[model samples]
Target: MNKLIKKKIKMKKLFSLLWLLCVCLTMYAQATKLTVDCQNPGWLSNKITYGDQMTVKDLTVTGYINDTDIKFLCALIRDRALSGGRLNLENTHIVGSISILDDCMSNGWNCLNGDGHLASLYLPKSLKKISSAIGNISVDSLYFSPQKIHAVSSESFYGGDNKKYLKHLFLGENIDSIPKYSFIDCENLTSIHLGKKMHYIGEAAFYASTNLKHLNWNEFTSSLDYIGPKAFLNTQWKPDTILIGDKIENFDVSSFKYKDGCHVFLGKKVQQISNASQWWSSGIQNIFLHSKSIVPPHISIRYDELHYFTAYIPHGSLNAYKSDDHWGKMNLIEDITHVDSIRIFPTNIVLGHLGETASLSAKVYPEDASIKEVEWMSTKNDVCIITSKGTITATGYGECSVIAKSKDGGLQAICRVAVKESRPLTAITLDIHSLQLEKGEQRQLKAILTPENPDDSNVIWSRSNDNIEVSNTGIVKAKNEGKVWVYAKSTDGAIGDSCKVEVITHVKGLHIEPASLTFKKLGDSFKLRAVLDPANATDTTITWSCATTDVCNVLEDGTVTAVGEGLAVILAYSNDGHYPSTCIVKVDTSTDINIQTIDYPKETQIYNIEGKQLTKLQKGVNIVRIRKGQVRKVIIR
Candidate 1:
């Protein structure tokens, strides 16, 4: 009986051990296949391991899901799981906040451990809103439909402790604004494609995102109105070009700050820069202005900012900007006017009768070009004469070609001019009523004839006095100091007009001011003014002569330019016989020293030649007042 009882006890112990082993195997299998399907009601409430800590290979919540299902899944992944291989919520009506960070923090999970083995996350297309703070999570990529999402709240992708694992972020269409600090410190985020409806970017939205490189600004919507201050501050991604959208209205200070050189192309309607100081601090080196953009007067930049910045304006707007109070202060404003082609209006024209005229006009390429000056020429002078002002006059019954050439670039447009017939000449009129010229001065005069006839409208020019001579083409030349009357008569001798011409004598004496000048460096120029004895003398022509061309050169207008460090004498002689004036120029060579390195004694005092105490060495010739009253000249290039 004792042996049988012992056998029963051994059997009972073995049965108990087998039962415990079966339970352990079942729990292990459950951990590996952690998945929840909310297709059926009360599916989450029916699960026994809903919020228990377990190692999960995959956690998927799919089919007919709601906010409660999403929150429960996030809680499971946040509190219960040791390692989540994947978390997918597909084809579910997920609405409301999905705060994974909050769930992890509330459950006392090791959020800083960065061991959440979540490699991928996919929110269902039915997700209508995401008003949660999903930051500091390690995920390789994130994709969600932004169709119903309005904005990315602050700290949405803030990588708090773990290094951001997000490589690409696809925010689908319909996202509007990105709140402040949304992606702050997301160091590993490389690329992001903004939604088509994204309009406003809040302050510091992308601050300290050092590794984020590329953002497709072209995908930005037309309704984008403002970019808040410091929106892109301290970003590592240096875009090559920043193209502002046409509908953008304002750019706040440091909105698109960058570290590398970039070119900014302003939109056509971007009329205001809220604070130009922000642009001054940005790394943009070139700016291309729109044709109609009006640079605001409130924009102010420092000298250092202008040193590396260049503004390119329309071809003809250079002078207009140069004359502006604010824009004129910019040193490197250039014209980018380029002509690709030209079109002449009225490709073919016909003048019905002699004395009948028609005006020709051309449309130049890049219509905003500043220089629209066209040179008009007639191919066949016997048929018609085209004035420089683009007026075609029928001379006789014939055909001719009129060409309009651009003065800026030599692009030409041609027009076929045909003279059908000629009418009787009634009156001849000169373009200029009267003319006054000094001796040796010459000018071309224009004449027009009226009252049509089939005859040549070319006029015959004559001068009444020998002092002034008129050419056959109506060019007047002043031969002597006297008054004369120049006449332009029609070929038929029916009617004519006269122009009074006056000539003045040459200057008798010339005096050059500042007889001597000194230059401290090469490439310096000084202007020499000539004073005539008679203040009203007409002949102010003077010749400039340099004693040594190797040392210095004098221009025709009496501008002495120093070529090297040497002494030179510049002579100014009056063309009308007067005592010549001399100017001695001495260019100092000591100022041309090239400084390789500087070594100064400790506590040495330095100053400039103007006796101002120097705290630091300046560019160019720096007169150093050294220790013990000893002076030295140092040139810093």
Candidate 2:
């Protein structure tokens, strides 16, 4: 009997425990969800009252809880204000995690409660997520203590237009991953100070926010395993710097896509840059590679789809990026030979660089006998160090021509000399002055004659300080108040030719003008005018006259008039015995036809061949009318 009782007691205890568990589950299920219409004005006053603290009885959404509920919820939260009082949601329970779509952040739905609100909330530690589309809000700061949260999609706390009041951000310490497109276009995200506990960042996490300038991240989590496309598509990194964590291993092209040639810094261990050509040609105008090892000969560079391109070893990469032997080809002379008839001085022996030094004597004959003088000139005529007898000395290396004959006619030979040094300016002469120069104007100096052997002529040149610069062309610029000596000096220091510059300052006077003027087939008249010499002129009286008056007439004083169609010359003269001038005048004839008609009373009736009516008149002039064709108007006298 005692053993049976013990067995029954144990069974009873097990059933009791099961019954209690079932009761708790039933109560949880019975707690119904309560929601308040945030879009309706009465909901806030009736359902939510300031300081009316209450724990969530059941799963309660105090506002219009829908996919678009976050915006309204955010608005209601910010509307409650308390000075020196914090909005605390510590005891409140959010039954399920909130997940917001990405568009809410950018579509004005997220720009709710645009004023800084000091709010505190205690989410269920089991809460693993929150709406990523929590559009830009003006919350001063948030305190998130959820333990199970792992990811927050991009734009989670996006401060679209209300980003101004979102100066501070408090990321949940438990959160490790930030989804792509999170915080994108959040212009007011000035700084992102993350807790050291966070790890991964999804793609385009902070892509295109124009004003977000600061980001603080954990250094140990640099190796972000996965980043979605364009994670930071429209956002900027910390204006000052970006710190990467250790966990990052691979990044898609978009990771650095928006950056303008900014190289991703992969610490020291990376060797032999792979696929770096993209970094080179991808808008990177220049690059600095710091290395001490010589570039291997077989190393190849790749860009776009091509491979094996010689890296554009920059010009300044000598010591920075080392390379092996720079190869080059040997230089060789293309052509060499001696041209015939080179001039030389009788006492001079042209020593050529025959590999070594050797006297190579050359004999030349003037191809043209008309040459009065023959002399050898260096390749650079300046080294014309030829003796009076026509012998040349190679004081320098260069090619030269052996000139024969006089200025009238001459023959020549070209001899090329590989000159090493040059001699002084040799004999120079200016052609004797034959033309006159205007007063007050400077005369250009020209070197009329060059030294036959300029190499020997140590000619140093200069213009008489009075005024002149000896141009290389031997043309002199007059510097003196008046024309001065334009000259040339020889290498032996001798002046050869000279010229006189006449400065004419006088102006001559002459005058001419038309006495009559006429237009063809138009009115005829005379225009009296005169001409004066531009060289020398003064106020002088001029008289105009016509040769005859039959077709044109001229006044005794100076006017002329056209009498009929014809050409005439109007003569003009100065009161003194000054030069006389004449002008031609053309007169036009009337463009009218002449018609003759005679009428006999009984002979004919109508008009004449020219459509003019015939008329009879007495001996005394009688008034008669001539009709102008096609009109009633008639001409009569």
Candidate 3:
């Protein structure tokens, strides 16, 4: 009976060992990649299995996490600290009014154990009131989205020398102030974005963050009203600028005692400037005030240190700033009427070719005003990229704007940039090379761009002069009676064939000089001039002909030549008018009779070739008075 009992006890011990092995294997598998929901809360078992020694590779817990869960997450944080991973609480609701760090300590976990420093610990949106509860936890970078989180403890990000890992921190818009000693001794910290809604900074809030070079005091939305005493004391950070964008009412006497070399920019709502010293004991350089109100901010600049710095105010506010009660004690005050405006050149450009680049520049008004820096930005980064100095590089096919702004703030200009593919527009042709139209006529011109499938198929039509007007769709309208060249220009700025449009004005009427011309004899000639009714007529060509070929011959210049002595008529015809003007000619063989000395009787009558009675003798050939049924044709000189 004793031997049987000994065997049974040995079997029981074996079973216990095997079961222990299985549990450890399951725990390790869970550590690798575990998703713990409320339905399957196995992560609670993991907390018991490894406690402070647990190296949780990954743990995703959803629905909600409370103070007790924070205790268990401390063990999971151990693996993340070692592996350098982020604890993302995005979409995972976290219960409010609890110190996450204190919960870890209360549950037997020490943040100073080197397992507290994680890559990141993203707090949730549900976190309205927060506290660190005297715990030290650090990360490489952290982003806090301020939804309801308004309250923060002094120990929130303060690790008291245990945290040396934080580099960047972004606080959301709802955080109104930073607690005292919040970022003290963060050796490697470089940037901190205390969002736009912040109004105050507690005493020594950023003390001794030697490497912190960027503070978000320059944010435009800042309504920062006060700064606590020695807020930036004992810090190695020396900035070049401090731009407060909104209402910043006050600064404590020694708020920035250790800060140096910063050019301060107070926005339109600045209420005061402390003479107590933000910079010039460290030597202030420039102060720019943007208040348009006639009532100046109460400035406390000392009279003795007036010569140490220069202050700039709005154009008409210089007199206000010069008064002793305002910024009047300032040694130098520049009234800014000039630098208030800026313009960007070369807007709405197209980069059509391969690897195309364009340089942009901005000009601030009044050539002599100081502070002429420009910043550039690209609206579509995927389509194009712009440098801070305003150089553009086309990356993809799309259209976006390259904006250039004055570093002084509001004045900005935009250059619309269109980036096309490497497929270039080789050549372009118009459907018609020449066009003819009457006055006040219109015609549409079509342009075909080649390499048939070019990158930019858009064509622009323009007229060379005022003789014609062209529309966006290439419709040409004759504005005046003249010829004009219409061009089709491609988007690549390449030239194409121009359409020559000639506007014609038709002849209304034609008239020949000299109502009637009479030649005395054969081989006699007279030159005549033909004129159109409107002097600016288009077709001036006239045809000359004789009704009787044997009697007279007419030339193109309306010259009537007597070929044979006979009664004849010379006709001049206008081609466009489709009408003719006639001149009467009488080529008589009357050389024997001297018409210059010929005188008729009182009862006698002289007549022309048209049978019209003439009272006086004309210069050309004329028939003399007939007496007793006798006819006489005489030449008149």
Q: Which of the numbered candidates is closest to the native, going by highest lDDT?
A: 1
Candidate 2 residue-wise lDDT, 41-158, digit = tens = 2244445443232222222333222333433345444453321123433223332225533222233433333333443322333334444223433444544445655666433444
Clashing pairs in 1: 316-370, 422-453, 422-454, 423-452, 423-453, 423-454, 424-452, 424-453
Against the unseen true structure, what C-alpha lDDT does each candidate score? 0.68, 0.44, 0.67
Per-candidate clashes come to: 8, 93, 3
> What stretches of model 3 exceed 4 Å from their correct place?
1-60, 66-68, 79-83, 93-115, 157-167, 179-189, 251-261, 275-280, 283-296, 325-329, 339-637
Better of 1 and 2 by TM-score: 1
Ranking by lDDT: 1, 3, 2
- Per-residue CA lDDT of model 3 for 1-637, tens digit only, reads 9999999999999999999999888766544444555322224444334532345544455655555566556655655323455566544554434334321222122222335656766665555444442255567777676576653433454445544666878788777777776766767778777877787777677776777777766672366776666676555555566655555566443455334334566666666656544442554444433444456776576656545455666555567667745356554455555477888889788898546788988898766445677788999988889888788888888899988887775578899999876667888888999988777889989888788778677887888899888998899988888888998898656567798999888788877788687776678889988888777778788998886989888887887888887788778888885878878888766666554566668877878767788997676767766778777775664
lDDT of 2 at 130: 45
Q: What does candidate 3 score on TM? A: 0.41
Model 1: per-residue Cα lDDT over 315-337, one tens digit each: 44577777765566665355556
At residue 466, give the lDDT of candidate 1: 99
Where model 2 places Cα greater than 4 Å from the true spot, the runs are 1-80, 83-92, 95-126, 132-137, 154-167, 218-223, 226-246, 251-264, 268-637
Model 2: worst 10 consecutive residues (lDDT sum):
327-336
